[model samples]
Target: MSDDGRQPDDPLSRFLHGETGALVFVREVLTSVLAVALVGLLLFAVSGVWPPMVAVESGSMEPHMERGDLVFITEPDRFTPEFAHGDTGIVTYETGAAEAYTTFGEPGSVIVYHPPGSGGSPIIHRARFHVQEGENWVDRANPDYLPATSCEGVPACPAPYDGFITKGDANAEYDQVSGIAPVVKSEWVHGVARVRVPYLGYVRLVFSEAVLVQIDGGADGVVPAVGGERVSVTGSERTTTTGVVGSASPTLATGSAHGTPTATA
Candidate 1:
């Protein structure tokens, strides 16, 4: 008999000593459930559906967001979609292909498209311009004329007086392939980038450039070739200009004349 008066080989004693399988099974089940819940929460945070996204690529938004930058993006909402011309943020698209055309910003993302003659899908660039009322304006690139009705059929088409265009500061011309009157709809915008965690976007930038190089077939030779894979440099920048929203007139600024200095948070 044990000192506590229980039998040395009692059923309860054996179970406590790992002789029974029920406890082990129960523990494994509980652990699995907890792990699944934790993963679900993580997905929600990173998807930008809750608040924002982390930067994963670099191109025109370089210097501002190097590879590995952590950007906090705000959830997309009706009120948040009204972008002030020149506001920068992360922009999310409804489709996987769309992600290729948008930039990740804290609380939002920016959309940039390819130039008229470039043959490829439109890409998202930093927000360099904004429209208020009916007049077109430029905020971060070269001065140019823009109309209010640019976004006529694109997703999240802002109602009369609630739309804006985005472009890369490094580009020479506006994106015409996405349509001359491409409008940014409220549904398409995620939110404005308010904070930036530098070096968090480095991985994203490397991945984006690598993918672009593969798509472009090593055009610039920036990407080195692997056994079966090839890499190249993709430097194409998309520009969006024109449009009106709110009460102020849109103005154009020269890209070469003035560049928006990179800001770090």
Candidate 2:
């Protein structure tokens, strides 16, 4: 019997008194988990999204964003800019350029969006421009970013029912042109990247990679997504921005720079 009139081996008493090594360890773990949960809840309250942070798995964004960077993201409607597009609150590169607005050092917002029918993680790229359904967007595209001369040759041309064209900063081609993703519908957008913390995301990346290797019987590699599965975006000079497509789980978005430039997140 314990001095306090409780059985010495009583789990509640032992845990309360820190008398059992295993119980103490369990308490510590629970405490740590609770703390993490609180922090996540706070972030969600502010960001209006679950898992408000993401790790950059590739260098598609390059000088602006990099692999191992931890990026903070908020729902698109959380902080709508004055120059934002319609109710989406996203400013495309075309509009940002004209308005002198910028994110990650260039015009426009860096957005995390799930491409239609991808069934993978979301893609993190800059919104280059908006197009209406059936509209020929080729004329508005930068010739340097397009592989084809006309709308007929481009893969996602004619707007695909209203969406944004995206690209990684370091890539030579737009995501649509390189087959990284199709049009990014406004509803498909998950969040907008606001800030980046360098090198902190490596922890998540390493942990996630290990789990994936065990589950899928594949080597640890980072494509994009919140889980261990990755969609490979391999290329050096030619990057392609794709989702689970290394984007991460459909529920969470991971980031990378893909272009034939080879960026995937």
Query: What are the RMSDs of all candidates, in order?
Result: 15.0, 8.1
Per-residue lDDT of candidate 2, residues 1-265 (tens digit): 6589767776576786784568888988887767755765676688786456566655567788766666777889887778899999899999999999989999999887655555433557899999899999999999999878899998888777888988878766887787667788889776777877676555445534411332123222433222221211211111132222123311122322221111244
Estimate the TM-score of every prediction: 0.38, 0.75
**Per-residue lDDT of 239 in model 1:** 11
Query: Over 4 Å off in model 1, which ranges?
Result: 1-52, 68-70, 76-124, 131-141, 144-162, 174-181, 199-265
lDDT of 1 by residue, 71-110 (tens): 4433343223334223333233222123344334322244
Among all candidates shown, the one with the greatest lDDT = 2
Q: Report, for every candidate in turn, its global Cα lDDT versus the true structure.
A: 0.31, 0.61
Candidate 2: worst-modelled 10 consecutive residues by lDDT: 230-239
